[model samples]
Target: MSQFGKSSAKRSKPSYLYAIIGVSLILFLFGIVGWLFLNLKKSGEMFRENIQVHAYIQRSATKKQIDSLQKYIEAIPYVKNLEYITKEKATAKWNAENDTTWKKFLDNSPLPESMDFYVKSDYMNKDSIASLQSELEANFGGRVMSEFQYPTETVGYVSSYTKYIAAGILLFAIILSIIVIISIDNTIRLAMYSNRFLIKTMQMVGATRSFIARPLNVRAVINGLIASGIAILAVFCFILLVEKFVPWLKLLRDGRNMAIIITGIIIAGVTISYASTHRSVLKYLKMKLDDLY
Candidate 1:
């Protein structure tokens, strides 16, 4: 009965170890996934803000000229909306912005009445926007043209920087993942090494490699699934915390996209778990008893 108790206790200890490792892996994976998701969300917002296009109509243009210009611009594809601001309205806006100085100069000077064209958020970029601006200026000529201002340089610089940053992040994540897998595998291998004699005994008794591999594989999958579940839960909690503190963290607004991201996290957790365990087991299976010692 004492031997039986010892055997059962040994088995129980391994189960607990597996649980701990599984939970650790889950948390690690959750952190990685959450970081990636947040970065992606920020990038999307940047793209939207950077794509804004502003058209300033000429001050000399009459209402009729401006109206014709507005209609012509509206005909183009991807033009989401447009707002026409008269000289009086512009002056009022300036006064509101700089109350004292603008109010004093209001009688002598006049602000230009300009048309503000807001293209569809996505379509407001350098090339297509430049094309549209050129078309507008060419068609209107001296009648209604002041300045077509789109922050092409700023957008381009931001885009280039984002690309480099994304690349660096990707490389770092891959390296980190590799280190994590190797570390976990080593820990599991150490546990298996403690039972190296038993594994060898089973092998000597004619246990097929597949038969020997089955229990380890089963344990690995179970461990992975549990870990993944824990990690996903952690991610959920983190997201909730972020939402509570930062109400503007509205990146995963689309339900479908959020679902996809959650699914990806689960998949990543499971895959990492499986791969780590498989490699660990394979390493031990090929090792000699001397090496185990």
Candidate 2:
């Protein structure tokens, strides 16, 4: 009986090896897609945060009012990189960008003092900015203009493009995940095929279902871990190789996101492997000796 079991296991050895390799490749591809999604999200956030919103101060406003407005805007949760741009500074900035200085055209600078700031990525949208503008105007009265200005077209374009890209990636990831699960299940079932006769022989000799399944289940867990480990190593190496060429991708490294991806891959591998193996074992045990042949 032991000799028979050993012979069955040997027959399944090649299939087991192929299953591990197949699962590892699938997992590696999934990990790569996850990493790409994370990097895209981070990059979008950085781009959105760079958009500068200029809240021009009323020229007739007093120093106290200007300072109060600056403090108030700075205190807002969505605000970042807040700066109180005085009239002189604003004029200098304008001149630096334009070919001619304002002094060449006029005696006094026509530029207004402003509260230049950026909003957090979460609030970097048309509706959010409009709401923020309303809130600021209601709170500050006439200290700062209600008509805050920024690149509205740029914001709209960024937001629309980001949503489309994110949706596309999400859809692709979902499809790929389903494919990976099915592929892993099929691979595991094929590996279990060679042991069908062995399972029948053991069952005929009074082996309980649990007794026949426990060892195979344990082997399944080990193989799952091995596949997960290989996939993780491959992902790490691929990232390192890519970053070496496109160094800017290294800037988007997010430890928390990467950790989540790793944990997900590990769980997927082990859970799918164990479930598929045990399911296949039970399936074979239910079949008659003739069916096994």
Candidate 1 residue lDDT tens string, 1-293? 44543664476467547654654564456465656555575566556553545567776677788788888777877775567777677777776777656555457546666667566545544666767877877887667878776677865665556568668767776886666556655555555554555555556677777787777667766666666666667766777787789776665455665566567655655565566555655666687867766
TM-score of each: 0.71, 0.92
Which candidate number maximizes lDDT?
2
Instruction: Assess each prediction's global lDDT (C-alpha) against the native.
Output: 0.64, 0.88
Candidate 1 deviant stretches above 4 angstroms: 1-9, 12-26, 29-37, 40-44, 47-52, 58-82, 86-89, 100-109, 117-132, 139-144, 151-153, 156-160, 194-198, 250-261, 289-291
Off by over 4 Å in 2: 159-163
For model 2, the run of ten residues with the poorest summed lDDT = 139-148
Top candidate, metric TM-score: 2
Instruction: For residues 35-66, write the lDDT of model 2, one tens digit per residue.
Output: 88888888989889999998887878888888
